[model samples]
Target: MSDRKNILFIMCDQLRYDYLSCAGHKTLQTPNIDALAARGVRFSNTYVQSPICGPSRMSFYTGRYVSSHGATGNFVPLRVGEHNIGDHLKPLGMRPVLVGKTHMIADQEGMKRLGIDPTSEIGVHHAQAGFEPYERDDGIHPDLVLKPGVKYNEYLKERGYDGHKNPWHWAANATEGAEAPRSGFFNDVANQPARVTDEESETPYMTRRAMQFLAEDDGETPWLLHLSYIKPHWPYIAPAPYHDMYGPSDVQPVHRSEVECEDPNPLAKLYQERISARTFSNDERREATIPAYMGLIKQIDDQLGILFKFMEERGQLDNTMIVFTSDHGDYFGDHWMGDKDFFHNPAVKVPLIIADPDPAFDATRGTVNDRFVEAIDIVPTFIERAGGTVPEHIIDGRSLMPLLRGEDVAWRDYVISEYDYFMQPFSPKTGRVPLECRTYMIANSEWKYIHAPGYSPMLFDLTNDPDEFVDLGRDPKFEDARKTMHYALADWSLQYRQRETVSEERAGQMVGLEDKFGVLIGYWDENDIEPPAQMPDYASGLENG
Candidate 1:
């Protein structure tokens, strides 16, 4: 009875798609990501084309658009020869097993737009793409984290921290240096049960390495795993019963009313004296503060209830294919924001639960798909469910497996969120942060759109303001729905970044001339992927116009 479905792919870094209680997110418990969204198919308008974190997981594993994988900025690097989805499902025999973190870095200009042969660049960037890294680390950096272990930094040094003031180039502050690293946030081990061996958790070391990789392997073979966590992404540290799980009178505050944020785009201003709401506030700071982000979303919902109770005690929970989402999201204090580079909808609308334990999609079990998917349709929905064939010249994402077989699939009406800062940092010399050509969005099923570069269009009609707190891009009776959504946000930013080739002859004008005329030509020196040793004369003079 092997319908061939093994693919776990759970990710939760900076998780936010309304912190799951089936996404309305009132208090945040996550009951195992709401029981894996009652057995899969959640997508209440998903997103993440790019908000951050390795260019939104590299435009979600090459469904493309980080400006067609130039990875369009953010510490730059990644360019390796395209074909990922674990090099296109390891050629149909399926085995893309990652089991944690797939931010996928690729250098050498992503290996010269992947024609392949900086050697053969496989997995994690195998020594400049020749292929070998099932795991590699090139001086791992994110201001380098993975801290806490002096009995958890001496339990954040008996707690009253003072860690990051004299120039914390971002990240530092969990009461600054130690203590609040929150080791078991004071785990009183009594009537025993909290035990996942809580050593100040990172979702019990990523669900004990995904339950020792789905209980000693055979998670139904045809794999694609991904895992990636760092905790509700922050030094918001949570250890004991999720560092207290919520109190300040059942914490839910921080939706912004004061400390400024009526922002109808006075260029959506920032740096309001370095924002706050530290471990979140508003409900008279009662301290359980959304129970330390719902104890780090129930410590990743108890490592997704230890990988769905080890896939229902290894019967392999009806054939596998989980998905639970998150790559970007976590503003916690909404408007008076704190994290996530901005383009709200609680920071790029996440939470996408997929679950599919098939009987050819058993009535999409427990069903909830409000359609509108996009994370570049998750690598052509894992290369058309591994039987493979999404190769529209390497990918632009498209297969939600025909809306996961409920069929009527039309999709892609709108869903794009992009922002840039080039891995955000540097100001002292005003060195970085340029190329501020930004974009923020939301579309009609009630409108939102934020738009940037000396901002202005802030619209929001999410039907009587679904908590986008009115700005209707500045009313005047919706001035013809703000000039019809400013030419429908310039036709949804030019038909989702339109370009679809034209060339009968305009190759960036004669391959953009090299040192011209007398030409000392310093570059255009094809270092490898050969063929054009000399095709020069189209009426010579290195052809311009």
Candidate 2:
């Protein structure tokens, strides 16, 4: 086996922080994921920069906040010049490859202006969020005009599935029934097994692709393989045996309260009124949906077992680093909400487990780290581990290598998550203008504060109500706490490092370069600054002229 380091970044869509057995999901036992956690450090309070998929993933890829990247919503293109994990890792001779979803939409306008063809090799990576994709599947094929799942659909057709229509919907996303199978898109039928077999499902298919990529690797170059899985997300359907793994008995009580629904802030009320939220709030819908959700997770765990065993057999595990995390969490009827787009823990906080092959990380193995970490930290961690310097000014997050090694470091006290809901239905319904349809959440271990431009701020005392049943946003009694959070948000916002073109060292070097060019200003005398030796006596030339 080669001594070069490799990183396998496994991301599961909509897998919540508490859904894994190691994370204390009582009924949903994930032995494969649990085994990974046993040999790794599980970050308990990890939060994403955004609760939504696209922005959260952009943050993870770029190591910058959503506002900084300016891709604050789904399908929003990341600006053309933005640096991502691929861009950063390439300089260190590490290749970053993608096998699944990134939720990345290319900045077509920016590319066009720069005269870059979309079909070019560089342009393809740019469009794919800086990844050389082995097989990129976002996994949502609804028979739409522009079908993004062309590769997966073709694979399904090649396997003797649907030939003419969208097999992703019928064979993979629909539930088996006595009559014609029902669409899994409906929560009512989500409990039924998918029409396809487990091996052919989306999870296993992606797993196979990842395995193929690893098997074909030349092994000379260090690589970071992003094995992203788009499951346990929605159209909540799981293939057989896993479909019946857990029933209603495994479903936990929904984390919501009448108090929240009765008197919610405008944003909270807007989310509660969404059709998906209302559907999830119903007992029958949740009962049907959660079982299939758990089943999908179990299927993912099994697939991970297969992938790990393959790596171990190939001796790849000896030098590879494995990271397991989710883009964001699902609300799942929490706080009277269904899908994620808010500040609640269920929607924002995600599970992060890192298993480094180096024996140095064994000290913190199987430990639960309560320190606040964010999605942005992953990029810097990878860069640091690959023997590259972390560009602190360009990347907003600190590397977690120290935390993994159980070293004492100055950790962050608060984490921020942002949401852009301009494209969501609630924005127009609530009469919110596009620019004002943003919300920023700042949270510590005890309190979480959400700031909406036109709406009253939402605050939750996590110390008292970890479930977040009550809102203290409009409460006058907690004025001091609210003020403190506001100040912290302001401090963080003011520190946005937008000047990426100039490094700190380069900026310092720039200080005297202008003076060397004789553009000196406000200098009382030439002696005030030690002129460079190359700089001749310009005064003598002036006098001679």
Candidate 3:
């Protein structure tokens, strides 16, 4: 067998860092995820580049920040030419295969302008965010209105389920006997058991399909399989046993202060008044959906157990590296917020565990790294594991290999996160909130700073206010500290984006008929010579090696 390492990159959608037992949640126990952490390294503080889906995952796949890649929101496409994890690893003889959702929209305008066919191999890769899809189910079934009948829908229909009524909802999102025509709202069907069996739900289906892919894999080349799960996100319903596994008592009390609702950041106050948080804040709604959310997580943990056992039995575990993390966390009504957007710990922080099987990392096995890490670092880590050099100009992250190998290394002193709330349909109608669209956060172990355009900045001394309940942006006592953080943000903002740097150089170095610059084609023979319209073809006379 080849000595090349395989990567099982697993990502859970909307999973919070504190939800896992290893991350210090007292109630929720993720044995399978905990097992991975116990066998490897757990990064206690990891932040996503963006708080939302598309931009966050784009940063993850491209190893660049949201500003760098320019996929600033959900449904926004990563630019066609951007190098992603697949683009980087495939050249190293590793197949980057995707088994689940990427949430990447195709750059339709770019493709059309470039005359690229969406049905072609390269076109399909760009459409799926640069990875070849083994199964591309983004998990928002009803949202696939553009293309009727998605793969998951067809899968449900094939199994005698009613696809006419949107079986994805019937089988995965809705509970048994919850009104024949239930609205596709979590508040309507929350905490109920799905009509389908647990094994037939989306979580188990994804797991089984992943295992099937492994069974059929040729195993001739090293591969990076991205097993992305889109559960524990919403619709807050689980199948059969998992649905009934938890209750309202299991739901942790909402973490917030009444004072937080008063004199809040303009955006935070606006978010609290929005439908997302308001809907989740109702006492009954929280009781109904939060438990279901926990159940969904439990189902994921159980499925992970199955996948890990299969890997061990197939002897793939010893040669494979397992990475578990999420794009971002759900607020869960923390700080009077529901969905992820603000810089609160529950919204920005995510769990990251990397289990390297290489003997060099044995010393760091079962260790925890508290230094702040970002989602961008994932691509670089994968490249390093695949024995490839990361493209520094394109990738904006450092490798964790040295830490994994138990070597002391100098790391970044702070981490940054960004969010753009302008696109959200629900805006501040009262006009009390500023029209600021962008929010940037620069944080270290001691202080967290938030800056929004045209609004009062917010600052929290994390050493004292770990939950970030108090904002000191206007406090005179914190003027010096806030100023220091502002400098960090300024430094971070000044870094070069360099999006077209390589493209421009490549264009300049290539001429009409050969790999030669027009000015340099005969520079040695004649200092300044115009190149021929069409260089003489030389391939025909070149001897075969």
Worst 10 residues of 1 by lDDT: 165-174
lDDT (C-alpha, whole model) for all candidates: 0.59, 0.89, 0.82
- Residue 341: error of model 2 in Å? 0.6
Best by lDDT: 2
For residue 298, model 1's alpha carbon misses the true position, in angstroms, by: 12
Q: Mind giving the per-residue lDDT tens digits that candidate 1 earns over 367-476? A: 78886777878878877777776755456668887776677856666666676643433222234356665555656576766665445677777788676756666657
lDDT order, best first, reads 2, 3, 1
- On a 0 to 1 TM-score scale, where does candidate 3 land against the true structure? 0.90
Please write out the lDDT profile of model 2 over residues 282-356, one tens digit for every residue.
887788789989999999999999999999998899889999999999988888898999989999999999998
Q: Is candidate 1 or candidate 3 better by TM-score?
A: 3
The candidate, 1 or 2, that scores higher on TM-score is 2
Model 2 scores a TM of 0.96
The RMSD (Cα, Å) of candidate 1 is 22.8
lDDT of 1 at 270: 44
Off by over 4 Å in 3: 143-146, 163-165, 428-436, 499-545
TM-score for each predicted model, relative to the true structure? 0.31, 0.96, 0.90
Top candidate on TM-score is 2
What clash count does candidate 1 reach? 25
